[model samples]
Target chain A: MLNEFFENAPCGYFSFFDDGKIFVFNETFCKLLGYDKEALKDRNVESIFTLSTRIFYQTHFFPLVKMQGHAEEIFLSLLTNKGQHLPVLLNAKREEHGGKLFTSCAFITVPNRKKFEDELVAAKNVAEKALQENSELLKAKADLQQHTERLDAQIQLVNKQNSELKQLNHVVTHSLKEPLRKILIYSERINDKAQPNILKLARATKQMRVVVTGLQQYVWLDNTPSHFTHIDLNDLAEKAAAQLRQELNADLLNLHMVKLPSLEADAEQIQLLLYHILSNAIKFKKDEKAEVTITATALKQNIFRSVEHKYKYEDFIKLEITDKGIGFDPAFKEYIFDLFRKLHDTEGHGLGLALSKKVATNHFGLIEADSRINEYTRITVLLPLFQTTR
Target chain B: MQKNILVRNNVKVFGNGTQPMLFAHGFGCDQNMWRYITPAFEEDYRIVLFDYVGAGKSDRTSYNAERYSSLHGYAQDVLDVCEALELQDTIFVGHSVSSMVGLLAAVEKPEYFSNLIMVGPSPCYINDADYIGGFERKDIEELLETMERNYIGWANFLAPNIMGNADRPELGQELTESFCSTDPVIASQFAKATFFSDNRKDLFKLKVPSLILQCSEDIIAPVEVGNYLQENLSNSTFKLMKAKGHCPHMSEPEETIMYIKEYLG
Candidate 1:
C-alpha cells in the first residue's frame, strides 16, 4: 500500500544527486514528462527543461538550492519528447544521502495561474501608460498658461511706456509751441510783398503744427482707459465717410457698405480706426472713381498667424476695408504698419496706419494689410467680441 | 561619502596586520559565508568582509536598478570599499560570482590589488555554439519563476536548512534568521544581475597574479568551466581541490585556508 501511494502521488517527485544524475523518480513524474522511469536513468535533470529554464536551473536554481539548502515555489516548464510544454511550479529541498547532498523536487502544474499572472502584467502596463499621458497633458497646459501670463505682464509694461510718452508729448505741445505761435502771428502781420520768402516761412510753420497734432494723437493711444460698449461698425463706417467727404469727391468716391456686426469695443477708438482707414482709401486711390467697400463678419477660424501668440482665444469680429487703390508690393506688407512707414507720397503724416495698428493692439486685436501692386488693398482688423482687460 | 559606501555595502573590517585581505560573498548568503575562512587569516592579514547592496546587511534603499543591473555595479561596490579604507596592494578573495566581480574591479583600477583568489568562477553562464556554459536560456527563466514564487516563503523554508552545520544548532538558526532578513525584491534582482551577466572577454585583461581554486565536483561551475578559466587567464595559478561542493570556504575552511596560504607564498 505504501509503494502504491509513492507511485500514485498527485504531483511529480524526483531526487537527483549532486552530479544531476537522476537516482529516483515517481511514476507520476515520469508521466508528466511522458517518459518511463528506466528510460530517465542517468539523465541530467536539466534535459527536461527548455533552454532558458536550463540556464535558470544552473545559475539561479542550483546555486540557491546549494547555498540555501532548499528553494520553494519555482516555476518551470517541462518539455516532452513531442515538444509539448507543461508549466509547473517546483518546490525543492536538498537531502543528504551517505554524506552526499541530493535534491528532491516536487512539480505541480498550474495553467490557470500563469494566465492570471499574464493578465495582471497587462493591466499594469495599461495603467502606467494612462498615468504617463495624464502627466504630459498637465505639463503642456501649465506651460501654455505660464507663457500667457508672461505676455500679459509685457503688455502692461508697453502700456505704461505709451502713457509716459504721451506725457512728454503734452509738455512739448504746451512749452515749445507757444514760441512758434508768436513767430507765425508776427510773420503774418508783416505781409511784405517784396519779401516772398517771409510768406513761405509762415506756410512751413503751419505745416509743422499739423504734423505735431498728428504726433499727439499717435502718442495718446494708451492714455485713456478703453470704454467697452456695444457699437455697430456700419454706423462707424457711415460717420467715417461723412468726416472724409471734405477730402473725397462724393460722385467719384463710391462707398459700399456690407451688413456689419456690432461688437463690445471702445467706440472712440473704433471711430478713429474707421476714419484713418477710409481716409487712406481715398488718399491712395488709383482710378478716376475710388470704390471703397467696408464689410464686417465673425471670424470662425484662427487666420491671424502673427498675433496668435498674444491671445489664447480664437473667436473674433473681423472688419475688412478693401479699396481700389495703388497698393504697395505684397513683400512690403509687414513694414506697412510700422511707425513713420510711408509707401506712397505723404498727404497725411505716415502715423495714420501705425496709429491704426496701435488701436487694434490696445483693444487686444490685430490689423494686417494684404495687397497686390496697382491692384486692391484689403486692410483686415480682427477684434475679440468680448472685452479684454488691457 | 566613504561612510555612505561603508553603510551601503555594510563593510566590516577585521584582523590586525599590514597586508589587507578582502572577501566578497556570493549571491544567496551574506558575509557570514566567509566567517570560517576569514578567522584563519585574521592573525596575519587585515581581513575585510562586506555584503553586496541588496544582499546580507547592506542598505536596501541604495539599490538602483540601472546601477546594479550588471556585474560592473557590484565591482564598483568592491572598489568603493577599497577606496574608503585607503588600502593598497590588497589581496582579494572572491567566491562564486564575486570572483568575476573582483576581476572587473581589478580591470578598472589594477593598482589597488596585489593578488586575486577566484573560487568557482564562471565568466559566462550561457552556452554558445563554440562554448559550453553548462546552461541554456530557458533554465534561467524557470529559475526566475522559482525566485518569484519562492520569494515570499524563502526565509522560512531555506534559512535553517542552509545553515546546515549540525554541530552548532544556534549558529545554524542565527544564519537562518540573517539569511531570511534580506528584502525579497532586492534578492531577486541581485540573483538576476549576477546570473545573467557575461564577462568572458574581460579575463584576458587581468595583469595581477591570480589563483583559480577549482573544486573536485561543482555542478554550478563545472570542471570544463575551470579548465576554460585556466587556459584563458594570463598571470594565474590553477589548483584542483579534493573538496566537493561549490563553497569549500564554508564546507572545508581549513583546506581552503591552506590553499590560500600556499598561493600567498
Candidate 2:
C-alpha cells in the first residue's frame, strides 16, 4: 500500500542527474507529461519545453537551483506528446549523492493561474501604452498653444506697423502737400516770362506732384486690404497686355505668353503688379521692337535672392518675365527693387519692382530680378498655388 | 541631501560593550526581524540595528533603483552605516540576503569589520552545474509574482498558507504583516535584485573572518550552500543549527547566539 501511495502520489515527482538525464520518476509524473514511464526515463526535462522556456530553464532555473539548493513555486510550461501546453508550478531540491549532484523536481498543474498572470501582464502593457499616448497628446497640445501665441504676437506687430504707416501718411498729406500747393500757386502767380525762374518753378511743381502721387500710392498699397479671388494668369496676362497697349498706344508690343495655372489671389493687386512689371519691360526696351516672354513654371524649391526659403517645400508657381531690354548691371538688380531708388535718369518713379515686391509679400510670396548689362532682364515672381488665409 | 542622514540608515543603537555588533536585516522585512535575536547579545556587545533603504522607515525617498540594482548597493549602504557610526573592528551579523551584502562590505572595506556572521546566507540563488543554490529562474519569478499579488494584503497570507508552518503562527504573521508595510513597488524591485543576484564568483575575495550559520531544513538557503561558503571562504567556519526554517536568528536565537559567541572566541 505504501509503494502504491508513492507511485500514485497527488503531485508529480521526478529526479535528474547533473547531465540532465532523467534517472527516475513516479507514475504521476509520466501521466502529467503524457508519456509512458519507461519512455521518460532517458529523456531530458528541457526537451519537453518550448525553445524560449528551454532557454529560461537553462539560464535561470538551473542556475537558481544550483545557488539556492532548492526553489519553490516556480511557474513553467511543459509540452505534451500531442502538442499541447501544460502550465505547472515546480518545486525543486538539490542533493549530493556519492560525490555526484542530483536534482529532484515536483510539478503541480495550474492552468488558471497561468491565464490570470497573462491577463495581468497584458493589462500592464496597455497602461504603459496609454501613458505614452497621453504624453504625446500633451506635447502636441503645447506645440499648438505655442503656435497660436506666436501668431497673436505677429498680428499685434503688423497692426502696430499698419497704424504707424497710416499716421505717417496723415502727417505727409497735411504737412508736405500744403506747402507744395502753396509753392505751385506762388510760382503760377509770378508768371513773368522775362525771368527763367518761372520755368524752373513750373518744373519743380510737376516733379513735386509726381513724388506726392507716388508716395500716396505707396501708402495706399501698404494699408489697403485686398479682396482675394480665383484668377487665371493666362487671362491676367492678356488683360495687362491690352491695358498697356491702350495706355502707351503701342499695338505692336510683343508679349509672348505661355500657359499659366489659375490661383486664388487679390485680382486687382495682382493686375497692378503685372501692369507695373509689363510697363517697365516695354519702357526699358532698347531694341526696335518691345519683345517680352512671360512663362509660368511650377517650382520644386522656393528660391530667393541667393538663399533658399523653405516655407512651403513645393507648390510654388514661378512667373518669369524675361525681356530683351536695356538691362542694368547685375550689382544694381537688388537696388532697382527699392522704392525711390533711382539708378538712371528714367521717365517714371523708380517704384515698379518695389510695388511688385510689396504685392508679392502681401500674397506670402517673393520676387527676384536678375539682369546682365546690355543682355536680358528676368523678373521672377514666386506665388503659392493656394494662398493661406489669416 | 546630507549623506550623514542617508548613511545613518535610521540607526537604533543599544547595549554597551567593548565590541560593537551591527545587525543588518535581510529582504522582505526590516530591522525588526532581529528583535528576537538582539536581546541575547545585548549584555556582552553593543548592538546596532538599522533598515535598508525602501524598507521600514529608512527614508524611502533616498531609494535609487539604478544604484540599488545589485548587491553592491546594499554593501555600500553597510559601509555607509559603518562610516556614520565610526564603527571599527565591528562584528557584522547579517540575516538572509544581507549576509551577502555584509560579505561584500567586509570584502570592500575590511577595516570596518572584524567578524562577519551570515545567517541562512546563499551567495547566489541560482544553481550552476557544480553548485547548489536551491532555486531555479522560474522559482524566483514565481516568488516575485507571489510578492506582487500579496504585497498589498494586511497579512502576506500566501507564504505561510503555502508553507503550512501554522505551528509558529506569530512568526509568519509578523513577517506577513511586515511585508504589507513596505512600498510595494520598491519591494518588488528589491526582490528581483536579491534573488537574481549571483555572488558566487566573489566568494574567494573575502578578507575578513566569517561564520556561516546554516539552518537544518531551510527552503531558501540549504546546508550545501553553507558548506560551499565554508570551503570557498579564506577564513570562515560553518555551523549547522537544529532549526527548521530559513530564519534561525528568529526561530532559534539562543542557538544562533551560541554559535556566534563560539565563533567570536
All-Cα superposition RMSD per candidate = 24.6, 25.8
iRMSD for each candidate structure, in the order shown: 16.1, 18.0
Give the per-residue lDDT digits (tens) of candidate 2, residues B1-265. Answer: 2355544476788896768999998876677667777887888888888888878668787776655776777787788888887899999999888999998787656769999999989998888888898877877786565544433231322233324334334444444333324676677778788889887766776778888998875657878888888888888888888864566665467788789878887
Please tell me which predicted candidate would have the highest DockQ against the true structure: 1
- In terms of lDDT, the best-performing candidate is 1
Deviation from native of the Cα of residue A307 in model 2, angstroms: 45
Q: For each candidate, give its TM-score against the true structure.
A: 0.52, 0.42
**Count of clashes, each model:** 14, 21
- Give the least accurate 10-residue stretch of model 1 chain A, judged by summed lDDT: A304-313
Clashes of 2: 21
| lDDT (10s digit) by residue, model 2, range A232-254 | 88788778889999987877468
> What tens-digit string does per-residue lDDT give for candidate 1 at A1-390?
988898889989999876567877899988888897788998877678775565456444665565566667777777886778787888887787888778899888888887875576457547856995798689669878987998899899988977788678877688768877898889889869468798788878887776677777776775677788998888887877787786553645678986787888988888899888878887788987668998765532233345322223245776778998987788988898887788886666677788899889877788999888788999989898877533
